[model samples]
Target: MSTNHEELTRLARTLNPQIIDEFRANRGKMKNFPGPEFLLLHTHGARSNQPRTTPLRYIKEGDTYILIAANGGAPRNPDWYYNILAHPNDVTIEVETEQLNVRATVAPPAERDRLFAEVVRQAPDFAKAQKGTSRTMPIVLLECVTEKD
Candidate 1:
């Protein structure tokens, strides 16, 4: 379904705490929530410079994790998306109770389309969301920022 800014903001405020709690309590598994798996993404705010942690559905591709900036199909991108764009160097991720530094990058255009299609194929709700909005959702890759990175 198409989402508005207010609706998305409200939903985030309401659901994130619970999701984060459950993800942590269960060691990164959110039981019945949508998608295959999840991670807690910590990013510095684009404007405020404050840190924000958001629970998000993800698909793991080897060492990288893929995220969709769907914002429940909102017209605008999620705050986390802009945050990562602004401070790509200052992001971290928590998965399976393990915290690690990570860097965010927008998947290349062609790859984004392919990955988006793959994601929609796996999660039909995302496909519904895509059909609900005009904006092109971003597909982000979060790569571990190891010492050698």
Candidate 2:
């Protein structure tokens, strides 16, 4: 069996780019990954400092976008999670036809359950993914950043 690291690597190098390409080419809609709202999250790698773009499913709360670091219910958090922690100020996201500067923050423990439950209610697959892993999924909030340059 392939290790989780290997699987994540394969996905990062292959499927991620395909999704990203389709997302941009189609004005942010992914045909292959339908259902559940999608967003393109741009982050810098924590170790290499190289740019990384990850396609994530999100649930929006008002103007804030909520993303879960479920890693498809793998044994570990996705790489972008660490990336956000290391460079929270340098994150941005693509939604629909607009690209927006955004800040990433992990939801506090007290609030995570409520958010996670809502996600499961809308997208039941997340509940199944959660059952497959031992670690709790982290809820990440991405809020728009407006800076006058």
lDDT of 2: 0.88
Note the Cα lDDT for every prediction shown. Answer: 0.88, 0.88
- Residue range 5-43, candidate 1, lDDT tens digits: 788799789999999999899998888786668899999
Task: Extract clashing residue pairs from model 2.
Answer: none
lDDT of 2 by residue, 13-85 (tens): 8887788888889998777765588999989999999998888999898999999998888888999999999
Cα lDDT of candidate 1 equals 0.88
Best by TM-score: 1
Clashes, model 2: 0
Give model 2's TM-score versus the native structure: 0.92
Model 1 residue 20 distance off true place after TM-score fit, in angstroms: 0.8
